[model samples]
Target: MLGGEEGIAVSGSAELRCFSAMASLLLRGIGTLVKSLAGLSCGQAPRCSSSSLPSGISSLQFSSTRCFSERPTVRDHPKRPLSAYIRYFMDQHVILHKQHPDLKRTEITRKIGQEWKALPDFVKEPYIVAANAERQKYKEEVKIYEDHLTPLEKKVQKAERQQKLAKRKSSRKRRELINMGKPKRARNAFNIFMSEHFQDASGMKAKEKFKSLFDDWGILESSRKQTYIQLAEDDKIRYENEMKSWEEQMIEIGREDLIRLKQRNKLKKLRPILKGPKVASKKKKTSVSRLKQSRKTAEPNEGRKARSRISRHEE
Candidate 1:
């Protein structure tokens, strides 16, 4: 019985040791994961400890793999300097937060704006000076950063920034359109047919179904296809009419920028200013010439009358 008890105690201790080891490994893994996430957020490569890593797996290999896996981001570059207004806003936010604890952030911001506007130029001078100094420093840093960047990296950065700008503009426009209840552009015949018969296509995958629909549309006779074309034309007219009225409403509300270029062009066409100058007809030109000739003949007659009157006076 004594031997059995001793054996049981040894087994329990071994079990406890196994559980503790597992917990430690899990904790180490979580720490590594957190560090990796932080590095990813900062757009930098994460460092791994050699001791934590498994045998034959070095930190160098891990870093190389991670670098290859992740795309470079603008965050990796030096941040741009804050503008004067932003610097002032940041400085005032803390004080304003404490002073107006009951007010919402937006209300506080409004108050800040009013106060900022009311402030004397002398009071704003320090923030302006600091902002200018920081801007100059940022410019120097940018030059240094650019000097280190390869041409390919520069090109990639430019493209990414352009893409980001385009995406932001597109999303903003879309949101505005949605908020304004803008009518959607009409789909063509193919799209109409696809919407009508997409689910009926004999394909499990979307791509396959799309291809099948496309193939069927191509083979469709002109008579049947004409029906879809007619529908598309009607939808186009509906979209145009709705868009025109919507744009007019928007113009009334002082949101002309929401109107499409095509719609603006249509509006311009409606104005008399855009029309070409009217040409006089041949008959009208002849009538004008005759009036000019009559005026010339009348002028001579009037001169003769004046001369006769002067001769009579002399007599």
Candidate 2:
């Protein structure tokens, strides 16, 4: 029993020693594997430590490195440039390749050289011609207006000339009329006789004298009957001659009166001595003097009181 116990103790010690060596080998192997995986993840080649790795593991890693290096990358093949692709696309799609039916190649090329060349005769040409004709027509209308205006101007000038001539003639006639005088030559013999005889008579006495003269001459009876019968024929010739002479005298008197009025107006304007209220008062006093003289000649001493009363009543 003592020998068996000692043998069991020696075997247990040997087993423990073998287990420690195996654990140390396993820890070194695990450390080397972690370092290799870290190198691979960082995109680098890992350094091998012969002391850390077994010979079989180093052989396996070398073998795998050949496989990774032999693999293909994107930079190997020859690449076409971007500019070349763009030029190809434009050539295929963008350039005008097809021809239009109306625009011929030769015509377009010629137009490009001579930009101002007339277009092929289209509908616009007729429209332009029509516009030119309308412009010409308007010019013709303006010419016609000018022609008519010339004639109208001539007519207006003629009318103005005729009006001026008429005005001059009327002015000459008015001047001639103004120069003519008053009528003084148409008094009958009986009127003259009465005027002379009745110079100192009253109104009643003058009437009585006229009646006596008609009686003495038989003028109240036969003269009246004969004169009435012959009046229509004789009066016409008599009145014509009388009026002619009277008109001549009136024209002469009117001319003298007009001259006197013109002198009076001129004196009033030019001479301060003539422009007085005393002159007008003197004229009024003279008129009154003439009236008194006429009244004294017409009224006798017996009727003077009555005439004075009548004059006072009139006033």
Candidate 3:
């Protein structure tokens, strides 16, 4: 009986040991499955510790929350219309931000139907037409102003040029006058003029006598003065004749062109009259036929009266 009881106790101990081992294995398998499910759900590597599981799960939840917060959300609020946004952009940003702000905003907005009635038809139509017409008109106006500016600039340039030219001419004249005042230059010029004009002995003697008389008359620089006077007179006469000839030639050319223009105008006027000559010829023929018919009717009564008188005398 003692041996059987001992056997039964040992069998119970072994069965208890086996059940403990299976229970430990089942717990380990469930823990691994839980870890694998947690890793799969959180998109993270499996952790060894139960303590680490809560923190990892919490981290994944926080990460998901952060990602959701960072994403842009479609709002449930009603949106403003596109036209309103466009109008706001144009008026507030485009118009106000310009360096030179347009004062014609009201007119433009009114034409675009953004603003209420502003200008009358007469005023508005012309402005709209002018704005929408060919840009070439604006270009042409700009060109005209540019052309005007060019002439103005040219006038200023021409004035400056004339002033420079006058200054140069004055400087040249002064230099010539200073050179003429020099004793050596005056002497050379006098010698050249005398050799040319007074080559004969009588003319030379007369010049010498004149010089002596001028010397007696207290004229110290007679020779130079006389040469300069003679040169001035000759230059004056030559310049006058040249100017007169040029003026006459210019006038003659102008008259010829004028006469040609008048003749051209007369011929243009006569052209229509000459083209209708056939109409005039037909009218003349009609008038001549009417005159011949009147003459035949006037002669028939006289011939009848003469016949009647001749018969009475024969009877």
Quantify all predictions' global Cα lDDT against the true fold.
0.86, 0.57, 0.56
Measured with C-alpha atoms, the lDDT of residue 254 in candidate 2 is 57
Query: Rank order by lDDT, top first?
Result: 1, 2, 3
Residue-pair clashes, model 1: 0
Every candidate's CA RMSD: 18.3, 64.0, 45.7
- Stretches > 4 Å off in candidate 2: 41-43, 46-315
lDDT of 2 by residue, 1-315 (tens): 459889999999999999999999999999998777556732455555665678767544433355445433222212222332233333333233344446665664554334323435562355456556666776677566545554546566567769999999999866765455322234454554455556544446767877766554454466554544464455456766755565446445554333335544664476566564568788999999999998888778648889889999999
lDDT of 3: 0.56
Write the residue-wise lDDT of candidate 3 on 1-315 in tens digits. Answer: 459889999999999999999999999999998775555533453334555557646444234333323433222322223333244336445544364366476655444453324436664554455444534465666566545554546566567769999999999866754453322222233444444545442424786855654443354377756765687566667655654454445345553222235554775688788786588788899999989988898789778888999999899
- Measured by TM-score, the strongest candidate is 1
Worst 10 residues of 1 by lDDT: 59-68
Evaluated at residue 9, the lDDT of candidate 1 is: 97
Residue range 1-315, candidate 1, lDDT tens digits? 469889999999999999999999999999998776666643465567788788787544455445555565543777888888888898899998988789899998888888889999999999999999999999899888888887768888999889999999999989979988999899999999999999899799999999999899989999999999999999999998998799889989988788988877776777655564545576788999999999999999999999999999999
Error of 1 at 193 (Å): 23
**What TM-score does candidate 2 reach?**
0.15
Q: What TM-score should be assigned to candidate 1? A: 0.43
